[model samples]
Target chain A: MNFIRMKYTKWFNISKDGLSKNNPIMIAVLGICSALAITNQVENALAMGAGVTFVIVGSSAVISIIRNFIPARLRMVTYMVVISSFVILVQMFLEAYFPFIFAALGPYLGLIITNCIVMGRAEAFASKNPIRYTLVDGLANGLGYTYVLVLISIVREALAFGTILNIRVMPEAWTDWVVMAIAPGGFFVLGAIIWIFRELTNNYENA
Target chain B: MKDYLKMVIFVLILGVTTATVLTGMDALTRERIEENQLIVLQDAILEASGITDYDDTISTFEANLEVIEAEGKTFYIDGEGRVSYTFEGLGVWGPIFGVITLEADFETIAWITVIDQEETPGLGGVVEERTYLDNYVGTSMYPELRVSRTADADDINEVDAIAGGTRTSERFEAMLNEAYQAHRDVWLTLQESAGDA
Candidate 1:
């Protein structure tokens, strides 16, 4: 009974919505561009996830702190500044500390500022909610996007490279599924994942 | 009137705050990023000269290779007269940075290594792969180098292009040729000076 009642709390609902009811990728279909671009390797997925997670949470908290004072005329511009500031910081940090991943991510690292999910959270939840709630919301949504990317990349990498995290798991004789290493492979895996996820969650759109 | 004043103030404060934060962070990381870039170029130069085994790439590069600066470009020369220099070229997506090492003749490719590139992954990204770069070894670069999907790799000036990354391959071919041309005069100058000494 206590656990059931816990679900009614504001934090719980916010987290649940971000993680499941309104998942950035599967349900809302936001940020699919990056999801497909970087999901060929699990390591890239993890690094990108961490980067995105930090930005979302950081930006959301900042927006929530100044939500009441944002000028109506310049609200969107303000969000862009904050979001891009975080993105540039991530780019520089990665370039300095993790040059290999920095080179691998290439232009996509800078594209995080334009990711719809980051802008969406800033517009929707963070702009109206308190900092405390926005923090949890940001974390949940970031992880939600991350886990899906990782799951997709696992399948893609294994089939494409005959390895998981570069560790060989398949028989040596197995020829790589070359298609699975490219954008079309991301499309196929992502489409199927969205389908399975929706069916399991009983989410159906009325046409 | 109050709304206008408040809006201006808010925008100014936000701009200043973001700029300050970014500037501060840049100050912290700028040196490290530059250092890492130098290390990468050095490592590629070392690899091109066939010095692959080492404890520290930077220290090994400093100790083993002699740096010769002339004609506005830097060159790394090993004991065997192999010469390595950095090359810059544009690819399909963005700039490609690499190191090209030449045998004593300054015509035959000793080795090639891409230090950085921004090509599409799994396609044009193959430019960075060892298998692809290996094709350049023993190929001649004088009078221009050709990356052909059809031309024979064994031909003196011909090397294989990246399959499915035709545009990138074409761009890479142009880039290598351009770099060789830019460096050719300096390479000859250095050779004359060495002979005079």
Candidate 2:
């Protein structure tokens, strides 16, 4: 019974670490490019989040399963190929079923191959962990990344376009802050989020 | 030697598996993707022709469209006599595709829609925005359309460009001009033929 409880606790901690303690975007600062670029609209943010989640989860699972077979020196290249294949699959699926979101994402969807969070998890966690743990870790990290993106997008879209998911949330009199719809806006929002999170956690030593 | 051989075989197997998976996915989605492209094109054409209530049935709208194949390209003539031409050009990153509709006079633009582009999001990608596209409506295509950073209300052929997307705006302008010039004579001839009939 104690052994089982410890196993469960380990799983919970891994998920907790991904969610807040070692959050991919806020804490580790991985995959900031897409976070900034796609957060202007809530829909784009959601679609990006979904795409990243799919890629990360798929890649982590595959990498974990094939970890033993990967040559140590050639591991990075193998990881890239696996990640890109999944990315392509996501891209094709989006193009066929969700063309609007696919078009909106444009080249950013293809750039998911370079998102460090996917690679980082594969290298640090998935390669050493069992299959189930790797899958859970991928899910946890992807969700963490997604939540941050959605939060930023809500602020950006409300301020920039006076809308959320293209629906007008702000009053007609509310003038748009054009900067909030661009890269600088993303940087400002992300910075403030990180600052607040760090302050609340009192984790300045890491920075 | 054994380890090296194993590594090579593993990589070879992975490559083959990836290729097979992608090929299968491509085959599965090819038809639907092509169909979606058609719908997007049709919708853009309808929007350009000033038809805002396009959600009902595309087939009904398509029924009134006369497709002309000339100069190895397709041009659409709606029931209202508006002519639409699809054009493609290089954006900063990839091809920018759009459909532009002209009034029967072939001089005044009815509307324009950027159907596809691979521009960087938020910057060059502003070309896809309705606000940016709205600037082309009622603009004259005579002489040539000029994308100006500054608003020139007096210049009928000039439209305001996206603030941060100057290069993309310029490329879009060039694309419109080239496409118009290429199809101008053929479109006019078709109009004349229709009039004669």
Candidate 3:
């Protein structure tokens, strides 16, 4: 796969579409609940980002492989089952290997089952695409969500706790902002970031 | 109809496959997960008793901490006569588990470590924090330990509670007092036996 001319490739296009044009957060407006809940801390954001990425890749691959045999009436049900299975695998692995993160994530770990982005990809892309394309799409979308979350968390954690990844970056006299550690603070930061992202990308939706 | 049959078969296969995979994963990881939990509890106990930087947690814990069971109660005795015991009780959302180490007097706290808790982060979750638990140090659990917003600064028995987590503070107060009372009886008996001997 010589890729000096990578911009012309189908995989590149799918990835570009996912990472920028149809981002899970800035463009698609998907998976906001988790984005808000976990972005207060950089560590939680990273853990959640990794977890969601894994779930998305796992479920998308499974759904794409079985897309042909899936009954029309069972489409939603199939997605639910596949997604939940992957979520449970994530829970078990984290509890076993990273118990600290497992405890930190709390209810949000189980709530991955309800994330719309995973199901959205399954229905829109995986069901219609081959596994090769599905994998790229999943990776691109997962990274897209993750980078945005990390960005938001950097801002929130710095302001909320005067630290970045638990390292004290702010001066000793810095007063912590309680709002940034709570849900409403997440809303404000996420909204601002989304607006700035849209401005930079020129993604405007007119009524 | 054939479509209905297809649906049923697809569901059955998916269910069985998911079940099999999860069961296999659980079988593989269950031991490690259980071990990880035990390691946390053990480490907390060791750290509470001022033990750290050991080669292996389990071995060092066994070598250092002596466990005694009396009246169906278990207590870990450190070399320095400090006593540590596991405590479990309800927090606001779920259970809180920790090890509380008391000084030789059995009244003043040596150290306290929250091994596991399910309180809300940045609020009730501060119960597990080192800074918050540090407040327990030198505080007497004699009579009862009070967690209050207006903690009497001079009173060692009263410590400042989490500012935004009143319910959690109240629950924590009750939980600690209950655990103290539960373990105090066995501790008293051991003290008397040692005095006589």
Candidate 4:
């Protein structure tokens, strides 16, 4: 039990456990808003995933670096300041460069700051961990979240347009399923994935 | 006291370093991003104008292009290299804006580009879909574009209006007509300016 109390050892163990396909979105059902909103197209999902991953890694590093200076009462503000600065930088860069995507993904990028997945990772993992391990944990979780998003977007885009990444994969005669492009379609696909993953991993946790 | 001061300094240094790195990346990528956006916008305009895969040089596109303004919206003309017809319309929601580059006779729609709209997705979003917008490509502009019932196959301008989006279709028609009128008005102004020139 004391081995679990070791700082670096605990950070690695918890990060792996948390991101192990059985945790959060797949297992505990968290942070599904952007997963629903941005998964309509693979390009949108990739942009969102890359943005979130950057913010999570940066914020985690900043929080870990400042763990000592942040008083208990102002810890939340400190974490938010770190997360938001990264979020704004991402937003400004996207706006200045990718105007079309910036238009489409406008408010959702800002909403990443409020995403519990990011805050949760900061408070639960980064707060106590060393800087090096915290960055790894943040990267793992971000990649895990991205993996789910790409998977969901793949199904939605293919079925909706009869293609992957907008390249026509289906024959001309194939009638496209128009329903797949609507927002609700993402929810149905996400739920099915979560169910399948849970069923597959349920045995290991139980036994 | 010294430990507290050191902690503050450490936090400040980390924050400053992060900002510098992010700003540096922004500076490097800003130009490429703008270039990509201009390409997409130009492509959208070209598609609406019924021109595709033209040489990417701006001068060629600009030479064949004309601008018309009326009723608060602006339009670009394909002009068939001359003053042809104009494509103007309001969108299903917001401003249904597009450029209808026409042949010199002003009777046929050479290409139509929907520049902006706030129409409902899955319904008005069809404006961007090839199935819908492409229909406007070769439509006749003689009696005006009409949104008749789905069963009305009597005329080419009589496109079947969107089923549930009746008001949107009506607004689209009105806007289309407004765009045409605006184009006509602007075309007259352009003539006046040219006559003086």
Candidate 5:
């Protein structure tokens, strides 16, 4: 079991250097811009998470399948083409079925193409990995993003509405901190979350 | 050179596929989307006008209303009944639009619906929620309705503004007042007609 597991982990599992030591959105903090902009509402955050998950998975799979064929000089362009196509598809589908969320999310859905997390995963992990491992990386990164987004939305919604996800979880007498619904509030909460995650996962280096 | 041509062909193929799929979906969904919107509008008119069970078969109230533009804004009214005009204004950074159905007297506000707004979701967007919009239900003004700071239901001049969204409240007041003034001149004619009758 050790021999087989180590062999698998060696290529697929994030390296110790990549783990808690270089957490993508926290320590390394590649996609913090979007983290701040789209964390104001639970609805937008959920839509964003879905869009990112779709784009990341699609891009990862596409990149892995074509990795051997892509010329080194043309690799970035190829990834961009693949990623942007998925982003447009997600945007169109959301507009069709969930126009309200699409309108709320506005231009941010299209911006997923530029989110460093997508390109970073493709370049850093998917390009070198097999299909199975490429998927693992995509799933891990998507979950990582969803975790942060949900955390931020919880704090923002609770403070703004005196509720969590529209449920009146707070006491009647509690005063909502109004600023928490703003973008600046998202930044502070997200920073604190990244810091806490870093401290908790500190033992695993880059776990 | 050949590789570049192949890449170009691939991009063209993908682009065409996406455009065709999205356009086809848009066409199929357009009618349903319009039907859904008409349904909401019908519901709103029925709810606000305080008329119910008049006709279940009706889908949309053909707004016989006309838009009269003046002073960089638009006011709407129809000949049959009193003028019920919608006003669009800015609440904080987003848009706030409402329906104010004037009574036959034209000065009193019979019904007001904050039809749509794009203020902060949980806080300011509460304009759509019952607690805030309900304040305007059955609301009337002898001269001009005023907004209160707290729950001053007794205050003749004020309505209790949403606690955290004071800016939105202030904007609504200003816009409503502007709308009231704009409609005042036309309202005089309706009053004159009532007097003659």
Candidate 6:
């Protein structure tokens, strides 16, 4: 009973760390390129978040399973192969089942293999941890990344088009801010997000 | 020698595993992906011809569409006498695909729908907007459609370009003109053939 309780606590802490303290997008500052690029629309942001989450969890599990066999010198290359395999799977599934989202995502979907969060988790946590812990870590980190992306997308889509998920949320009188729909807009939103998160956490060392 | 051999074996195994997994997934999704592409193309054709009720687009298309093969190109003649064809052209980032429909006279654009594009989101990507595409409708193909900055222009062939997507708009105009010129002769011949038949 004590062992099971300890295990549960460990899992909870791992998830907690991922959601807040060691958040991939906020504290770690990984995978910012995609977070910026795809957040212009809420739908795109959600699709991206789901894609990244799938890639991270899938890659982490594989990496953890193969950690014992992977030679130290050839580890990075092996990780790349594993990561890309999962990315390709995700791409094919999206193209087949969700063609509109697939088309909207375009090259950003392929860029998931290079997303720092996936590789970072594989290196920092998965390679050393057991499979169960690694899976939990991956899921936690993915959720963390997803929440931040969704938050940024809400801000961007609302300001830029006066809409969310392509639906008109703002009144007709509200003028669209064209700048907020572009790349520079992503910078301001992401910067503000990092600032707010850091303030709330009161962990200024990384900031 | 032992370390080198180990590295080679490890890499070989990894490569083989990756290939096998990808191949299995490709086989599983190939049919569905192809079907999706066909649906998208069909939707583009119907939308270009101004058919908005897409719940039965495929059946409607089959019932009304007359496919003409001319000069190794496919031209679709709709029930309303408009002729449509897909156009591929270079955009800022990647290839842009559009379906353009011509009036029965074959001299004016009846409608246009940008089926696919890989332009910068919110900027060049405005090319896919309905407003931008609607500008092409009713434009004359004689001088070919040209994108101009000034809105409410008098020229029948001139349309307004997206403010921030100048390069993509320019490329789109050039692509349309080139495609129209390339298929003009074939289209005329097909129209004549239909008239005779």
Best by TM-score: 1
lDDT of 5 by residue, B1-197 (tens): 98888667766765586578657766776775666554455555555555555454243244433445654544445453545766778889788877777665565565677766878877777777867776775566546777677655665446778788888888888888877876676656555776999
Q: How many Å off is the CA of B40 in candidate 4?
A: 3.2
Q: Mind giving the per-residue lDDT tens digits that candidate 3 earns over A15-105? A: 9988999999989999999999989999999999999999999999999999999998899999999999999999999999999889888
Residue pairs clashing in model 1 are none
lDDT of 6 by residue, A1-207 (tens): 686677568888899889998999999899999999999999999999998998999999999998998989888888898999999999999999998899888889999999999999999999999999999999999999999999999999999999998899999999999988998999999999999999999969843
lDDT of 1 by residue, A73-187 (tens): 9989999999999999999999999998998887899999999999999999999999999999999999999999999999999999999998998999999999999999999
Worst 10 residues of 3 chain A by lDDT: A1-10
lDDT score, candidate 5, position A141? 77
> Per-residue CA lDDT of candidate 3, range B61-106, in tens?
8999899999888899889989988888999999999889999788
What is the TM-score (0 to 1) of candidate 2?
0.82
The better candidate by DockQ, 5 or 6, is 6
For candidate 1, the per-residue lDDT at B73 reads: 91
Error of 6 at B125 (Å): 6.0
The DockQ figures for the candidates are: 0.82, 0.73, 0.76, 0.21, 0.13, 0.76
For all predictions in the order shown, the interface RMSD in Å is 0.5, 0.7, 0.5, 3.4, 3.7, 0.7
Kindly report which residue stretches of model 4 are placed more than 4 angstroms away from their true locations once superposed: A1-11, A36-45, A65-85, A91-114, A127-130, A151-207, B1-37, B54-79, B82-97, B105-108, B134-161, B173-183, B193-197
CA lDDT, every model vs. true structure: 0.92, 0.90, 0.92, 0.73, 0.72, 0.89
Q: Across residues A102-143, which tens digit of lDDT does each residue of candidate 5 receive?
A: 777887889999999999989998899898878766776776
Candidates 1 and 2 compared: the better one by lDDT is 1
Report the Cα lDDT for residue B182, model 3: 85
Query: How do all models score by TM-score?
Result: 0.86, 0.82, 0.81, 0.67, 0.61, 0.82
Give candidate 3 misplaced runs (Cα > 4 Å).
A1-8, A157-185, B52-56, B70-72, B105-109, B119-197
Ranking by lDDT: 3, 1, 2, 6, 4, 5
Docking class of 4: incorrect
For model 3, state the Cα shift of residue B27 in Å.
Answer: 2.5
